[model samples]
Target: MANIMAASMYMKIALVCMLVGTLLFVIGFSTVSWMVSSAYNRWEARGVWKVYSCGTSFCTYLSYGAWTYFGRNDYEHVRATQALECIGLIFALVSLLVLLLYLLVDSCRRRNSLIAFVVCVFAAVFFIVVGIAVFAIKLGYSYHVGWSMGFAIVGAIFMFVGGIMGILQLTCR
Candidate 1:
């Protein structure tokens, strides 16, 4: 039974990692694409592009919020804190998914699209590390060795790469 439980825990950890990793990857792609699309639209049209640009900004900020919230420890109101964090995560994930569909269908030929794809893969890897950290936390593992700043740094690197891609799109494409 102990062995079975350990296996189950491992499986659970893997599933969480996969889901979260994929979601983060999607979010990274959406954010960079949103920036590129909004920039292009802003110059092409009148101020009408504000709507789309603002929406993109909102999504980017929310993605950051989701990551920060989930990455924190608010133990006073555990359920409420976690619920809010989950909501943020869900919103970020959904926005990314929508943005991905748009890119795949309407903008695959763009340079930013390829950059987005690469960032997504990187984000996925970081999320897997985060998942492992979460598993360690649950199993009463050491914080320093388990869920440490390493995962956070990895996540930051993904966003940084996405930002660089966004910047490059302005001049290169």
Candidate 2:
């Protein structure tokens, strides 16, 4: 009974952590500030999908001129980073389905469900970590790394901890 209680606690923790991680990752993944730089009194920002200017209080994604000075010309690994992070985001979102299944289906409440969810969480962390690492490495030192990168890293850490909690939940059974 004690072990079952402990496992239940772990499961809740894992679920909360994974949810937070997924939210953070999604925010960072969408925002246009993963990389930022200022030149000629103009601020430019880059995210997974768009490169825009944050020179004014409100950013303008339509500013093609903004990227001419940075981004693609300067970074070789941008596309790879996008691919890895996208894959990670997809895995994280898909893992939530396992939780839904466990809640809705009697058979999915078994240990295998926990294992599958944990594996998906871990896979998400793996791809996110690699993507962040690649971006951090390939991005020029002259530029200022933005909050989006930090968010992505923190998100990956949360997912990783969640995965550990999930493993503990499995052991209790």
Off by over 4 Å in 2: 1-7, 54-59, 62-66, 69-76
Candidate 1 residue pairs that clash? none
Can you write out model 2's per-residue Cα lDDT over 31-145, one digit (the tens) per residue? Answer: 8788888865777777777777766566678533345553555545777888999999998987767855654566678888888898899999999999988877765675677
Name model 1 segments beyond 4 Å from true: 1-74, 77-84, 107-145, 148-153, 170-173
lDDT of each: 0.35, 0.78
Model 1 Cα lDDT, one tens digit per residue, 117-136: 43543443444344433433
Error of 1 at 116 (Å): 13
Estimated TM-score for each candidate: 0.29, 0.82
- In angstroms, the error of model 2 at 89 is 0.8
Which residue pairs of candidate 2 clash?
Answer: none
> How much lDDT does candidate 2 score?
0.78
